[model samples]
Target: MKLKTPLLLLLVALTSCGNKPDLVQDNFSFASTQLKQAFVEMDAVRSAEPREKQALRDKQNLGPLASPRNVEADGTLHMVISRDWTSGFFPGELWYMYEYTKDDFWKQKAREQTALIEREKMNGGTHDMGFKVYCSFGNGYRLTGDAAYKDVLLQAAYTLTTRYKENVGAIRSWDHSRDKWDCPVIIDNMMNLELLFWAFKTSGDSLFYNVAVNHARTTMKNHYRKDYSSYHVVDYDTITGAVLHKHTHQGYAHESAWSRGQAWGLYGYTLCYRETGLPEFLEQAKQIENFIFSHPNLPKDLIPYWDFNAPGIPAEPRDASAATVTASALYELSMYDPANGKDYVMKANTILENLSKGYRTAPGKDRGFLLLHSTGSKMHNVEVDVPIVYADYYYLEALLRKQKLEKEGTAIL
Candidate 1:
């Protein structure tokens, strides 16, 4: 069958991914080239689009799919701003630029973004603040030793800890509506648990770590489907503590896998394994990875359709954003499984190469946003096939991971 070629190619690709020092050296050269290119792009973006004028909060007012291209739809370049759920991701993007190039321009943007976020703060009662803020700020403080970043991150962590409901033994999420849903949990929230776990170590607050672990356990028990693909949303009864319903808000149906959400589960559980060393978490991550990689319908690039099972192929389109997230997750997972790490590394490499080569704009259409063809909340029918800020963030993160692995003389595919 024609489809068999990619499967056969996957096996063949795995062979070259062995523990060859030359592979590491080759990867290092490639990564260095890309990093240098990223620096060039970041500097160009910074010079062209100054941070103060286009502050972080500008993202709030913009409509969906409202990228820098949104300027075209409207007369003024009304940049969206505000500390929303997607708030933490922008800083992560800037931090990646700073980390790779040591560019003071990126650092200044990151600092300004952090200050703006802390000053207003988002609807902090939800669990996502950890990912949207702490992952950016926590990682930022760890890298720079900047006390201001530390202060803002600590405040955000404290806000998250305060929301930990002892009754449900988990953190609550999204309180704008749906009042009856007391102990609401999302698989996406699992990635945010690392922020709390890190907060515990940074601040010596065991409660934060304990809370994160409990929340993770609760999610593992409730969210995973029979096939190991996770649900987008799980409603837990605040009183009886039973799972009320497992649904998929972002997917086509309650059972369909939202590609990015699945990536979050794969990435989050791997993170849980790293933090707790629990075999179950790693086991789940591996199972999810198998489901993700083994999907026959995935494009040659390995980036998944927005909903893998969504009817219609080229007409419906795949979410390059999901592929980017999974690429970074697979790269992180590769570190733990040396024997099979190459398969993941190869998959990650496939995704990144395709993204950089296929999904990236021609460097002329969009000067500000880096990667292209990212889907943001396709269920709500918004931001289809445009640059998502977080997609650029994860794409850069994957690159940094490759850079780190190559520098450490590790195998890279």
Candidate 2:
């Protein structure tokens, strides 16, 4: 029943995902009036775009499902359609839009965009199956309970598990060997565990669940530093399972924390706790939160410099993507911890507010990207200070989470 899949390597390394079902009671109270303007404005912006037609401009990025990348040399916004991790995010965006508005236009667009990336379910070479498939199809299944989406998701999990090594007790993150990296695992890989965990729950398959658990445990053991800040990449010896090297592929230095990488770790482990109810995962999430929020470099607006330790400090470009992810993770984190949840809820609200004003794009502008100022790989000198699809995806996701928490007293992770 499991069909075999893959992540971004050149553009990103092990791009992004989660865990068990938790019985959560939402007790927090908040007024949801402010976000509706952003929601309505963004919806109108998205509705105005001919996304399906524009996506056809770049088959290299995957085709009609391509999301906006950045401005090309011609001063027009460029879109990319790759088997890259971010490909599925566009569809996920539409899914969220549908969820938020209950409009048939978003629903139809979601289906069309989702259909373009179905081939990725069989792409087993990359480790980003969760970002590629689950973000799109997983949402589809969650919303519609379509059996076809379920099949795609199950096959995607099977493909993802192929990358797991019993010796390493982790799924290999990158296939390429750079320097002495024989088997490289990036922190971003932590985000891919959601698909496997979801598969186990839906199919009653232990292989998927066990692999997800082991990978989370392994990453938890090795990825974190003393302050709970994380290394972006950890290479391992295939046979001995020893760490070969630790470096930041996208951060300022090998020792610096990449903001989005930190976001990935926070979101990933928090999700693992949601699925497994493991206290360790929750504690890890807290430690990560402490490291990020307590860090002196964090802007008062909650958006972070591309790397917390980037040399430029305040001069560095802020990564709205990291802020969006952190806010989204914090909203989910608020569900389980009574002592910290209130603070997290406040933090999440502040982030949403800052992003809506400082980072939001006007209607019919910036290629209809929801949030701006996301940095992709500052090291590669690409996608810097640009609108990124994942930033928007998580931004909308955080907004939806806030809306749900306010209205139903429940956060849907």
Candidate 3:
């Protein structure tokens, strides 16, 4: 399927057909089965000796957010937490749980987490707030018609809009002094633009779409390398629309390919194509996929390291979080172009299988986190192989995708 704009928009609408008994009912069965197993494992890990004894606070009082301790691969609970508030993402995961299982626990947690993130006022600093909030509460509203979620999403959208710099032709990633490059763009921000698109529909506003197109076009021009691999960051001279320089802020170095960031590009552009039917967006998505899947660094199980070109991964282990995100993105992409559907589906499946098998600690090991070996920020030597909230969210989403497929047998567009 070519997945033109009208067809993709139709699919997006159908995604919210929660009342469809055949789809939700069948997937709910699979979700319930896996969730039951996960729950038992979580409980056993919670009651384990190591976690009970060396709680996050007891170890070194790493930080407030890290207080909810969980075991790492080294069989120790890491404490030194940085960043107290992670917005949109934390609550977003909770909302996914609520949607998947209709569990009140997930809904309650979403409300609590949203309030906590809002209290910290973490909205305007970066583009991540859209993914963090909309993926959770925005989804909540879309699926359930909850007006409250709309209020939350709109507020977050306003915060995102205020960050827009007309002079730069892009939204600023950070407000740091060291790097004051105007209109700097990151591939990860593409995921955030979905919320902007949604805001346009809700408010009948053109500004949101204009911002999204500018961001998308800027990324298309600057971030992509010859092989389709992308730079982690690109600074643009907002005035002349000239490329200032390309740098890898989060990856190993300027030339290194970060697997997770590439995944973001693939998933983000696929989403852009879905909304706009831009042939360029679809082509870019395919280009990124070619680079990612063809890389020799891909593990046999299809999970990726934190960086594709990282040195001696066994010595300094890679992040399984990258794999989880890629899996979910591939699953989403499969619907658009079924020619490579099985390849992407199988890749996602392999990652999920490996994660549920090896990466996950056994029962009575790590209660709160579903997957281990997630690297948060390798540059800072922090959370080298600990649980990350985003990894957990994506892992659950991949599982949902698998369940959705096995049950629904591919809803033909």
Candidate 4:
């Protein structure tokens, strides 16, 4: 890919200011090598003794578990089945590799990984249809234009719509947290709306578009604080469409802003704006950016503590995953706001630079996961300060967005 002249000059100036030159290219190179090892490790695990493997495979709904989720505390690679929300992220990373390198090898790898998750299209019991299906099949279709992938996407979108409660105007997020929330809707659900929008476009079904729009509007009304920070979960009265509770499942407290939740809002609304050209979504995304960047507690390195209100402050674990998601969102948000485009790119570049310099795994470490120090849920003490799959997925996505901006003067939608 060749950089357009003006963006090339702008990127050069931005890199000279602080970032390492060719940061995007260098990261992708690092990712390619790391991901190759990830594949080997995953393959080895899947080739375990037949009886033991079959029992494990049965737990994953009869499919081989190949997607890396995280490394366990004891230095073991943790792979998840398609039913896991995170299963799609590694495949998405593989797609990103193919997208950046245009290498047939990565394409084949992505296809193989993505195939493992195709069964998720019919999984309606969980609200993570988008996370499970779109991240894998959606990217696959986008790159390959495979008709089969399109069918999977359509089915997944339909399955996701099943979770949308007409009274609540939002998709139910978790079915298991029933004792706490009658009809729970989460900020994370915003990320899934993109799959619905794509389904509308592909199938010409206005229902998908309307459901996504209504969900975005509803979440905007109910989930946000005065400062634009969001609550992690909002429980609704299924009968009356009234909010029953607003609290956090993953943040420090009920009122705290979960860092990854904020990043999800940023990325979600930006894509909503891209898909709908709605000024409200664009304005919402900008407000979220302001809240994040202007917060005093955000680190100098641009990574965030697990929660903005976490009591530990500098002692808190940093979530590199949040930074990567925000970086990727800002690159696209920059395109939508020409007045602030350069500033957004500069900020995003700084984040990428910082993450690359400090937050990445040491070379040949961590079973090929790229970025490190991501907290899955500090409140639950899960995956604290560990390398998680989604962090690497968004890190590569950010790099790809930066590359597209420099080369074509536009970020991919």
Candidate 5:
């Protein structure tokens, strides 16, 4: 699952080729073109389904398969149902498109896709309400001020709180794999706290705020090592509130730094600082930034391998998803840390440029996924090197943030 050596060399060359004045704008234009074609192809697949199947889906109240998760082994579109954690990302991408282009077409498409995930507002089986709902409906609400979207977000926030265990001081991450973990809380759960924060601000509920802060504080204490590299999963004794195990579930080993987990910690703590103005959260984010950018294993292009400690070095698969997340977090972190702001922006820009130049799917290829070579879970041998939905979501997000920073000197949007 390693990237071809020739492609890796080309990526390095492209990263060193220097930046262009219109890189963000040009990439946005390219993304819009590619996504339009993707939408058409996706819709065709939905339309080609048998009438009986469609009727049964309607009767069962199953929403249309509106989100593109990834491409299957045969290169067919792998669209997912509403409950999938990634279901919100495609709609979020459409929202970013609308935000960038201000086109009614993208806005209408965003609305349609966002609406499909509304049923997940009550899905508390997993600790990914933010990924499954907020990225879709939350963005929709942010853009349109839609009252219904607001209601759904608040309800989703309440449902997410159901997973919170006061004893563990964290939201339970998984209900399955009971054999492996008592109360597993993964680093990825940090990303879901955004929904709770937003709900607190919107609904004036201290419960939402407290749960988010507790989770952040608890995770800050338990999930990270002295070097600020994070474990992928931290199992806890649910009743005793004591740490039971620290597992690198998706990484190279029990103690290796999972690339995406590091990105999540960096982004999550940065966001926590934004929401709560806590110096500790800011410092944690900075430590993670240093760890990622200073790591010798990080590629010259700023795209990290699937695991920072993966044994294969140059031959390991790159995770474009991690780069996208890191780039997006850096744009926000730059706004907060002024002394290093320029450097963070420069690194983020390099990542975006390298991704655009080297990792992007060829025009009209891979069913129009924006980028390639993301590893979802290398340990499980899943999605080792492929185009993932969240990579495209965060790529669009980073592009939008870059544009905002350029125009307004702020990356808030």
Candidate 6:
């Protein structure tokens, strides 16, 4: 059945009144059972280790916002211990865990880890303040209603805006030397626009909303190919906003589709539609959704190779990070497109099942990071086939979203 309205009624519509109600409910019930088991396994990992406690106390002596990134060969938790794009994911994971398990242990850890990066609210040198701050404090405030978290989020939103180049109509993504990139705007920047939207909604400041819409419009004009597969980076002339180049720093080639960039574009546009109720953004999202599901190289499990055009085919690395991000995006998108809501929800559930059963770490392993086999930069030969922090963050997020739908028949707000 094609959905015409997406809401809490979707689960009921599928299982209670559909053609094969029993079969549908049975499969959905089993999927929910498996996810509940995953929740237990994750909590066990957290309870078995004091790693986060130690990291919190030790990070002060190491560096700023020292988020745990991955595990070392010796089974020690490798720390970011510096400014990087992924620093907020760990804390965001903690917040979700706290919300899921309702354990004070995770709540305290979430608070501690979130506090470490409080300074990113003022650091505008890079364009990743959203990833570093919003995912941390944004979830924190959403769940806890702490006034302090609100203040930090607003500050980070403002700091993120400082990177906006009026001429380019987008935020500068990288801070490489002036000669190297006149004004670089990456597809990943789409993920950061959520903070700006939140800023405007919460603060009643249209400045934040205007910049975000402008950036989205500019990216929609330039970043996409005819197929809705996106370029990784679009460099603009700093003075006149003219196109300088469209390049791929992370994918297989300049013309290939990078899996994670595509996920970001899908999620970003879905989010833009939710925030603005704009038909164009929803159409943009559905276009990317169809591209991802119809892509020739997508695996049976729905995970994509690091690059859709990568030469290695089945031998190329499967990106759990991209899959997790897409799972979360699809779950949210399902709530908006009723005609395809059942398909979207079922696909999201399938992705969660694959990750929970196939890509998840053995408990008490992976330095307590949950998922495995995420590729960071396969072209650069960095962090290939290893567990990554952002992968875990989105995995937990998908879990939570799925759980919400299972129980309350609503998407996570």
Candidate No. with top TM-score:
4
lDDT of 6 at 65: 30
The 10-residue segment of model 4 with minimum total lDDT is 57-66
RMSD of 2: 13.1
lDDT of 4 by residue, 1-413 (tens): 98899999998888786754578878988898899889778887777637777787787565767589998777888888788899999999989998888999999999999999998888888888888889889999999999999999999999999999999999988899677789999999999998999999999999999999999999999999999999999999999999999998899999999999999999999999999999999999999999999999999888999998899899999999999999999999999999998989999999999999998887677899898899998788888889999999999999999988888988883
Per-residue error for 287 in candidate 1, Å, reads 0.9
Clashes of 6: 2
How would you encode candidate 5's per-residue C-alpha lDDT over 69-124 as one tens digit per residue? 98766777888789778999999999999988889999999998888899999887
Give residue 220's lDDT in candidate 6 (0 to 100).
94
Error of 1 at 163 (Å): 2.5
Better of 1 and 6 by TM-score: 6
lDDT (tens digit, per residue) of candidate 2 on 143-257: 9899999999999899999999889999998877655688888899988999998988988989998999899988888888898999998888889999878889999999899
| Two-way lDDT contest, 4 vs 6, winner | 4
Residue-level lDDT tens digits of model 1 in 1-413: 35588888987778766644342234333434443444444445446765654554356442221112221222222233344566666667667667766769768867766554564233555667776677577668867998887777777777887767776777877675586455667778877787777778788988888888888888778888788888888887777777787888778788888888899888888888887788888888899999888887677778788887777765776787788788888887888778888898888878877776677654434435566677766777766666666776677778777767656844221
Question: Model-by-model lDDT, in order?
Answer: 0.70, 0.81, 0.69, 0.91, 0.92, 0.82
Q: Order of all candidates by lDDT, from best down to worst?
A: 5, 4, 6, 2, 1, 3
Q: Could you tell me every candidate's TM-score relative to the true structure?
A: 0.80, 0.84, 0.78, 0.93, 0.93, 0.85
lDDT (Cα) of model 6: 0.82
What stretches of model 3 exceed 4 Å from their correct place? 1-85, 119-122, 179-183, 409-413
Structure candidate 4, residue pairs in collision:
none
TM-score of 6: 0.85
List candidate 5 segments past 4 Å from native: 1-21, 48-62
- The TM-score of predicted model 1 comes to 0.80
Could you give candidate 6's per-residue lDDT for residues 214-316 as a string of tens digits? 9998999999999999999999998999999998789999999999999999999999998888898999999999999999999999988899999999899
How many Å off is the CA of 27 in candidate 5?
A: 1.0
Off by over 4 Å in 2: 1-65, 72-74, 178-180
Question: In lDDT terms, which candidate is top?
Answer: 5
Better candidate number, 2 or 6, judged by lDDT: 6
Q: Kindly provide the TM-score of model 5 when superposed on the true structure, using C-alpha atoms.
A: 0.93
